[model samples]
Target chain A: MKNIVIGQYIPGKGLFYRMDPRTKIISVITLMIAIFLLGSIPQLLVAFSVCAVMMWVGNIPVKRVIRGMKPLIILLLFTFFFQIFFNKEGKLLLDEVMHVTVVSVLGIVLWTIIWRLLARIGKFKTVLLLAYIMGIFVLFRFLPFGYSFTTFRFAIYEKGIEMSIFVIIRLVIIISLSTVLTLTTKPTDLTQGLESLMRPLKIIGIRSEDFALIISISLRYIPTILDEAFKIMAAQASRGADFAEGKLKDKVKQVISLLVPMFIIAFKRSEDLADAMESRNFVPGKPRTRIHELRFGWTDIGVGVFTLAALALTIVLKVIG
Target chain B: MSYIEVKDLSFSYTGKRMILKDISLSIEKGEWVAILGHNGSGKSTLAKAMVGLLEPNQGTIAYDGVVLTNDTAYDIRKKVGIVFQNPDNQFVGVTVRDDIAFGMENLMVPQKQMLEMIDFYSEKVGMKDFLDKEPSTLSGGQKQRVAIAGILAMQTQVIIFDEATSMLDPYARRDLIEYIQKLNQEGITVIMITHDINEAMYANRLVILKDGTIFSDGDKWSLFKQPEIFENSHLELPFSLKLAAALDDSLPEEKAVKDFLWQSISNT
Candidate 1:
């Protein structure tokens, strides 16, 4: 449970860390738009280099940044595969027919069994498994199993390969850019930034501070609620209620056993919280002062202007193409 | 006028039975009072009533001569603060620093003053280094300290601790009791609501509640002299007193017994 990193913020003293959270949020959004607007390889390289430099200058650990991307591996691969298979423009690179015969089938089965065993030993590293799978297919082509049971065509084109790489890089850049925003800004500051951004909604009679408070309170209670949920689960388990080992209908019943108590606890907690808030002199919709005031310095203005410029340039690039 | 005055206080919640009934109490400035009771004894309700968190069905609570009504409750809250039982439920800020600043912010204190108060009170609570720490990462005790820090930053004249240490471990409870004692020593009025006779021992005055009424109100010595009061409230006598009673059947070596009594009670 402690390993959840969706809202993780690492304290640091760097350019991005020092920038105003509002500025960082606006800049990250603009940069992401620019990244998606990138069309040619040169434009992609420029955007990639800028993100690399930002990461380097921000002093963010590269290992942690890569770890943050682990959850995206499947989505990235899906995008890569979809582009490669669906795209058919540009010159043909390779086209071949492969046979599925007795010996070839034997080799394929043997390769799969060996690969699975080795993958387990290797901790199932994605790149290693992929390479091993590709190597076996290439090796089987040389086995010369001419008594064919079936055959399938395998082809690759220039545009397909180029499109896959471009799209994958775009996705990576967008992810890393947003990661930089969340990693540098503390959760409090993030919500405060959101409040500042939503200030315009005041014209419509919406109080931004209330919205920010709701978000922050939700973030604060998520872990505490989860902790209670786990305790409730353990208590139910002690009473012969098996949540993990149960039939479909039984699982639903067990889940309700957990949910009912949780809902009660949550409602009671809210009541207590309201009482506490009132005791602390908190009045809703009342003006309040903050200890950590967000000040827009010259550097913030500079960053804001730079991001705007980048967004404009991307717009121009898109128009030209 | 007394520092805090609650007169003829009777309260119930939404057509429910009376939780507190016709309770009148007055606390002097700089006094430490313990309102002791068992689980449904209405001591907690009395605490909330005193702070204007709950309006009485038929009575008036006044602080520094101003009676608390709907219009003046907000103003009175500025002078009195409460540290509730559940630490997680009371925490309004994401971090310790912000939590400490919460009360001051509500009063629209200047940013500069709020910063200074956060620093001073957080240090007073010994949570200076945990200013950036989130509430979830902190222990139940640490969260309570942050809560106290928030109240202290408000600079309230009277602090009502509503069983503040009930949920904490023994060590944490002891630490918090010492801190509260120090606060009382510094001229702040303290009203601690608890069922622990041992905790009530630290207060200069003890008010026992039973069945939604004041059973006894006096010093600990008087309360101890009346053994029935303890039994009626379901509060346990300190082990030393029970031991001394078993040994000789009469109070002996008055000073020695008192010293030993406090020592044993604190140890637990």
Candidate 2:
């Protein structure tokens, strides 16, 4: 449960922590743009180095940032595989044609059964399964003797692997930079900074202040609602709701049971919150003052300049290369 | 004039069934009053009506002679604030300091003054050091204390507590009760709506509700003298009060019952 650290603010006192929130927000946006705009390996290396230095200077733990990315591991892997298998623009590293025979089919089946039996005794079952899949691919490439219909060709290209690496690096840098922003800036400041940044949109009647309020409220209540939902889930589980051990349909039914109660609780909470807000004299659209005033300092200016320069360098490198 | 006056107040949620029926009560300045009742007795409904959260179907509530209507609700709100039950639901800010500042911010308090008030009220509630702490990390008692501090920061003259300690543990409830008592001592009018007779005993006056009507209203000692009324209303008596009533012929003074019980227990 504690692993759900995405979008959560970690209190800190690093340089980025003290830098103005507007500066931090702008810098993060700029860095993200630069990362996506870079075309060559050298540009990516530069951007990655900048991210690494930012993580170190911001006092952000690399393990914590990686843990924040844990939920996206599957998606990252999918992107990597998609790029590797589909992008065919470079020199072929390996190409082979093979025939399949009955004996090889039997051998492969026996090997899978043995591996499954061995996997039962393994501590890292997932790692073992991945290894088993890789072994199957190697077996097909080398031995490749099943039936004639099962025989085919396999190829690996340099461009595919390079494209996959680039995509993965882009994802990592974007996720890491955003995580760094959240870790250093408190949620209140983040929202306030966003509100200030979007204040210009108020001329078009966008109500950025209200939007910021909504974001802040949502961020504040996500963990709280999750906690409530977990409690309800536990309560239902105690009453024979088999959320863990159930068929797909049964699990979905259990989910609806949890969701209905959660929605009711959320509605009641919003009504109560409205009352509380009114009692506290909160009238929407009225000018309100904040206790914490945001002020830009020298560090903010320096960071702002550095981010802009980095963005320009990436664009120039993209064009020149 | 009474500090708060509610006359012939009747309210219904759907206009079909009455939640509060022709309830009339008045509270004097600096009075510590507890509205006591069992569940579904409409004590909370009355508290909401008094605070202008729910408009009565018939009758009027006035604060310091100013009538509470649609136009005056905001002004009355500035003078009266409520700390509701379910501390997590009432919290609007991510952090303690922000929560305390929320009310003041809505009132359009200047930043400097808001900071000073947040500091003062948070310290008064003993939550000064926890200003930067997230609300999710705090205990039920601590959250309620922060809620009270938020209300106090508004500088409201009257503070209505709608079962504020019902969800708290014993120790937290005691801590909250002590704070309420201290606030009353400091001349902040307190109207606590609770079903706990033990908690009701801390108040100067008791208003017991039953079936959407006022069943009984009197000073605490006088209310305790008539244990049958408590039994009729389905409210449990505190241990000392129950013992005092059982040994009625011997125990003359209601206030001495607690000390007597302590002495007897020590001797035994």
Candidate 3:
């Protein structure tokens, strides 16, 4: 659970860290829009280079950034497969029909047994697994046995691969840019930036300050709530709840028990928090000053202008192309 | 007028079950008062009422002559602060420095003054080194100390500890009690609500509550003299107090009780 690092701010001293949060946030949005606007591979390479530079200049650890993308691996894979299977443009890479029969079924089963044994034989299991999947695809394309009427055709188009790479790169760039912003900016500054950026919404009757306050408070409590939930889980486990080792029905009952206690604790906590807040003289809707004021210096201006220029250049090039 | 005055205070959560009943208490400026009670004995409820967190169903609570009503609750709160049990729950900020600044921000203290107060009070509570650390990362004792620092930054005349150290270990509890004692000695009124009679011994005055009412309110020495009151209130006598009572001989004092115990153990 501690590995879940969404919205976490890592302290650092770098260009992105020193820049005002509003600048970082606006720049990230602009960069993301620019990435989406890129039409050709060259433009994407440029965008990727810009993100790489930002990551480097921010002193963000490359390994940690990749770890941040761990949760998106499944989504990236899904998009990759969806684009590859459904897309039907550009030159064809493979087109073949293969038949399946009792002999082929038995052969495939035997092959799978061998593949499983091979998978366990070495440290390169991932490589072996990929090779096995490719082998199965190859067998489906070329292997011939059984009735022709039941034959299956498998094809791969060049455009499918290009499209998949494009989409995946776009997603990676967007996610990494946002991660950079969160990594560089503290949660309080982020909230303050959002509040100030959305201050104009006050004319439309939206309380952005209050909204920012709620978001900041919820972000602060996420880890604390998770810690409490784990404690409750442990306590229930000590009482023989058997959350880990149980039938589906019993596991669900155990989960419900945990949730009930969590909800009760949360409600009680919110009540206590209300009392604490009130005792400290916190009045909702009243203007409160902060100790650290957000100031937009020359660096913020430079970064803001640079991002806007990049966004405009992308839009113009995309239009011309 | 006393520093804090609560007269004929009564509170009922559902208008059916009374949590506090006809409670009247007053504390002088710079006095340290400890409220001791068993579980569900309404001591916490009383603390809340004193801090303007809960509205009493009847009676009035005044701080520095300002009545704690709906209209004046905010003003009254500015003069009073509370450190509740469950250190994690009361934390309103993401970091220790932010939590300490929370009250100052609410009071609209200027940025310069807020920073100075945060530095002074955090150092006073011995949490200057932990200003950047998250509240979750701090120990229970450290969190309570941060809470105290936050209250101290508010510069309130009276600070109430609503069993704040109950969740801490013995060492942390003693460390917190020492901080609270230091704060009291600095002319801040301290109201400590706890179930630990040993902890209550640190206070100059002790108030014992039983079943939603004040059972006894007097000096600590007078309260320790009556072991039956301790039993009736479901509060344990400290080791020295219990030994003194069992032996049917008055002990010299709390400090002497330990020396006497050591001598007796050696003699035996």
Candidate 4:
């Protein structure tokens, strides 16, 4: 849970980090639009390069950006597999008759056992995964022995490969653009920026200040609430509640034990917090000053205009294509 | 007139059971008072009532002669600040600096002055270096200090610590006690609410509460004289006070026993 980097802010002093959070937010959104507008390979290359340059200029390490995408890797792989296998269009690239015979089945079982045994060795995980995928395909294609039970045809097309690559690249571009925003801006600043951007909604009687306050408070308490939840789980575990090793019915009961205490603690905390806030003279919906006031600077203006122009150019190129 | 006066105050959450019953107390400017009680003794309710967080069912609380009501509560809050027991719950700001700024912001302090006060008060609480650090990353003691810094930045005349040190370790609690003593010495009226009698001993005046009423209230020495009150409240005397009591009982005179103990210490 700690490794989840979506809202994590890495403190740094750089051009992108110093820009007003609103500008950074706008830039991220603009780039995301540009990424989707991109149609051809060259356009995608341009979008990817822009994100790379933004990461570099922001002093965000390439490794950190990749780390942020770790959880989505499985989803990306699934999408890739689904797109290539399901979509049959354009020129055919591969057509093979794969046999599911006894030897092939035995080979797959042996490969699975070896993969499970070596899975705990973290350094060889990528190599082992690649082998695990390729070895199954190899066994299905070449190893035909005993009595053949089934034969299935495997095929791949040029468009399938092309669309899969495009989809993966597009997702990466969007994720990296947003990752740059979260990594550069503080959580407080992000909420403040959102409030600032949503100020125009005041005409419709929407209170953005209150909304931002809610978000910021939630962000501030997420870790604390999570810590309390884990503590409750531990306490329940000590009292003969097995949250992990339980039947579905028993698991629900165990989870209820955890949830009841958590809800009680959360309510108690909010009550205390309200009292404390009142003691501090915080009147809801009232005007309040801020310590770190956000003001646009030259860099913010420069980035804002640059992103707008880039977005315009992308739209133009899309129309032309 | 007293700095704060609570008269004939009674309160209850459900109205079925009275949490505080006819509680009347007064604190003077620059006085260090400790309100001590065991669990569910209504000590915390009394503190909250004084700060106008909870209204009394029967009587009035006046700060500097102005009565505390719903309308005046917001105004009175500017002069009084409270640090709650749970540090994580009361922390409203994302960073230490913002936490200190929270109160001042609510009172509409200017941005420049707010920054200056954040720096000055954070330094006073020894949290100057941690101004930008998140509250979650901070230790329990550090969060309390940040809370104190926030209250101090608001420049409140009266600061209430409602069992603030209860969640801290012994070392952190002692450090905080020393800091609170220093703050009281510097003329901030300090009202410390705690279940630990030893912690209450640091204050000049001690008020022991039992069963929703003030069981005993007096100067420290006077409360020490009434050992039965401590026993009734399930509070133990500090080791030094206990040793002094033993010596006074065994020896001929209290002064003679103190002199003997001082002489042995000086000889060593």
Candidate 5:
């Protein structure tokens, strides 16, 4: 199955579903900048509220959004504890005798920050668009980057750690944006947008139709593969195959057995695809009419403007704060 | 030139088993030839070899006097296409539209032509509503319909049905046979591999195989006249033909004997 569902996109006339993928993508970039640039409490709160409103407008169930947080619960808790106990720079919300022991404080802060940030990165990719953005704010307190001990510990202060942190944060924002785009737009519609967006690249001798066909096929292949995987699993179960009951070696062997059948099916499909393609007389450099043409209505213009505004605000906040 | 000519063709599979030994056959333009044999009799192997899917160990295969080579095999494929037995294995596209478009793509058909051809062939197969439907959503018969449409859309003069209708239920099989007969009437050379003697009866020509050898090659009447041929090839005669033979003891010179037996059975 594909990393994303293809034509399996939900069909509806909902407002969020009709927006351009490009605009949605740009909006994601705007959110990323805003997340990174916000260093103060007011800015972070504003970012959090914006994500929350978007989630409501998109009609996604809030419970499902929060359910995605299950994978990062530990990281979230760590970050919150780190921020409370170690980040002495922040205001003290609690106090106790011997509570602020230097070793414990440092370890807790380091571990908490690392886990919190890791949670955001993981949730951004795992959660849907609005859910991912909400996750960024909700998971902010669980940074796992800090230490979690009450005693002496070894630590490294290097550029590698710094880069890794930034990389994870960037991945979250990018994933969140793509999540929104995929959830709201149909794959076919997205392909058209991709084609149009790449139209300018024709001057450099790139044909967009070929690219569009590849994308559309890939998207279509995803759901089919997933369905095939489930079928294979069921077939294996019926034959007394077990995935969870095996030891490490047995699991590896079991997975290998599964791959054999899957590979056979995939190769057979590729051959058929080649034959089908040959028979259909599909040639490069041929013009074809799209039955479903994407048009920019006034709503698109409004969305574009809103996206640009969001982007401008994000940049200004980053520079100012 | 004949539609397709294979002179003294011979092939062998693994273990030095001779399959299609010295198999010389020529199919004229617009002639429907039915090849009949039991399983492992090399009938399907011969059919595949003729379509350029399998290479001949000895002997040349030609279409319209053009030799079959790597570069020229494609041209032969354009003039001829094979529909395999399994419908699921025959399809490449997830959707009917894509599958039909697939054939046209290989021939380098322009996008506009591909669309028109896809519509034309899908309609030909009577799958208008299923154009956008996924291949899995179709029934076995419907998938065959799509497969046939894929070949026909390619406009191949010679189409080989390699047990194409074997997987379908009786009703669907009957309909598919009728559809194929219609294509034969419309001047498309059809070659079908089947053990069904009744289905092969519709062909103007028949070749019966036994143990990788042609046991009987002639008109349907001649082939049926030799009961030994059916015994050796593991085939059963159609009921009417068998009844006609049984009545030959009383009416030795009866004309239209099959018709007489049919009338008797229906009246009974």
Candidate 6:
């Protein structure tokens, strides 16, 4: 009945939940911004290390955190493919197809190393999780690790330094921090924070209350929708519906059978909500009472000031560079 | 004055097939009423119409001498909050606390008072620990408890449970019924629509609707004098009541069929 698992939360008295939802939101955005603004190797090194430490503090499971990157697998390949021939230093994996720019032996080595480092520690940090996915990789068969592009194109040895372990440690930080914010704070508080953050947009007649309603409703119902889908899949599976062995066209028809029950449940839920709301005399108005109070305190200010100082120092370092 | 006066009410889903056909029911204030019939028997439609969620095609519904319409329905609604059949459908907030807070937020209660009320009602329904948890993760009974907490926090004068305990297991259902009984004792008017005849046994008034019309309406004790009522109305006697008939040969018991059955069965 009510016991439905959507995105399961790990109950913990960790620092993540102890922090206010608004504070968590602000810190997440700030850290993400810092990760993007960083350019130099030392800055990336520092930023990535900080993320690593935060991940360790949050106590999130490392593999589960890494597995979150399953969707971004294609993006990594695109990064590799785009930079490969253009590096113009590594051994040519293949001759330029239809006059595509050719890679020298040195190009591939530098591209691999730089891509591995940046994509793992960079804004979209999924490479740390996917380091071991062995598809048909375009390896530089002629470049050496210590040698630069200038030296590698003319060389013949296939020696290379393995991708670093620090990258996974780096990713564990980003995903763990994400879990810190989302898994600990309830969705209502998350929207309350967003509503407060977007208060300036109210001048344009975009009411945060209405926006919060949309968010809370979706947050509340999407899991139910997914659960409904799962239930239908199980029900049909029990009924000997041939979802598993069917051809593509037959499978599509089988999946469509699920749409009927899902929509019925959805409409029924909506109707019930409307009835409950009407009975409660629910009216749209100002001065709404929230169960959880979103507070800003000394700790929030301290966290904010610390992050602000980091931002300022990052700017200064960038200027010096 | 009739607490709820429905006069010549008629309705259809798409203007073709009428769900309620010129039905009229007068439920006096402080009355605990059970609207009962098989599925698609217009019992739920009447409940919806009573709360102003559904517009009857004809006639009028008035509460405490005030007509129920969109213009005045808002005020009437404050006096009535419904607990739906499926515990899942009525819950609307992200967390148990937030879900209960939805109606309060809509009602626009002050923040401090809202927090107090949330704590009070959550504890009232024994969901004090689940305030921070999502509704999806709670058991069906707990979800219904949260749903009850939400309506209870609203403090409406009339509460309708539309098969609200169907999803709950037996033990939780008993507890929920006891909760409702306590609310009714506190002078809150409760209306329940149920197919479960046992649930109806607990109601003060049972209004049997057969094919969009009231087949029988009266106190629960007196209604069972005619055993044939259930035969024609698509209802069966509660298991307790049926068991009471089986024990008629052995010992003296209350004339109330359900009580007799339960007593005789338990005495054994």
Fnat per model, in the order shown: 0.95, 0.72, 0.74, 0.88, 0.19, 0.81
TM-score, predicted candidate 5 vs. hidden true structure: 0.68
Q: Relative to the unseen true structure, what is the C-alpha lDDT of residue A201 in candidate 3, on a scale of 0 to 100?
A: 95
Residue A171 in candidate 5 has what lDDT? 39
Task: Report the alpha-carbon TM-score of model 1 versus the true structure.
Answer: 0.87
Against the native chain B, what TM-score does each candidate's chain B reach?
0.92, 0.92, 0.92, 0.92, 0.92, 0.90
Summarize candidate 2's per-residue lDDT along A138-222 as a digit string, tens digits.
6665664545557776676899889888988889999999888887887778889999999999889999879988887887788
Better of 3 and 5 by lDDT: 3
Query: For candidate 5 chain A, which ten residues in a row score worst on lDDT?
Result: A148-157
Model 1 spans > 4 angstroms off: A1-6, A96-124, A128-155, A233-259, A319-321, B14-16, B242-268
Residue pairs in collision within model 1: none
Give the least accurate 10-residue stretch of model 4 chain A, judged by summed lDDT: A1-10
lDDT of 2 by residue, B120-161 (tens): 999999999999877777899999999889988888989999
TM-score of chain A in every predicted structure: 0.83, 0.83, 0.85, 0.87, 0.61, 0.67
Q: For residues B64-84, write the lDDT of model 6, one tens digit per residue.
A: 889988898877777787888
lDDT of 6 by residue, A255-306 (tens): 7798888888888888777767657776664556666667777767877787
lDDT of 5 by residue, B1-268 (tens): 5768877778887738788777777789998889998888898888777766668888878888988866677777888878777676666665788777667666667777778888887887789789987765677788888888888877889888888888889998888888787888888889999878877887878988777777778887677677777876788887775777667555545756666775664342
Note the DockQ of each predicted structure.
Answer: 0.70, 0.59, 0.63, 0.63, 0.23, 0.55
Error of 4 at B266 (Å): 18
Q: Candidate 3: TM of chain A?
A: 0.85
Model 1's CAPRI class is medium
Specify the poorest-scoring 10-residue window by lDDT in model 6 chain B. Answer: B249-258
Model 4, residue A110: distance off in Å is: 4.2
What is the Cα-based TM-score of model 2? 0.86
- Score candidate 3 by lDDT: 0.84
Predicted model with the maximum TM-score = 3
CAPRI verdict (incorrect, acceptable, medium, high) for model 5: acceptable
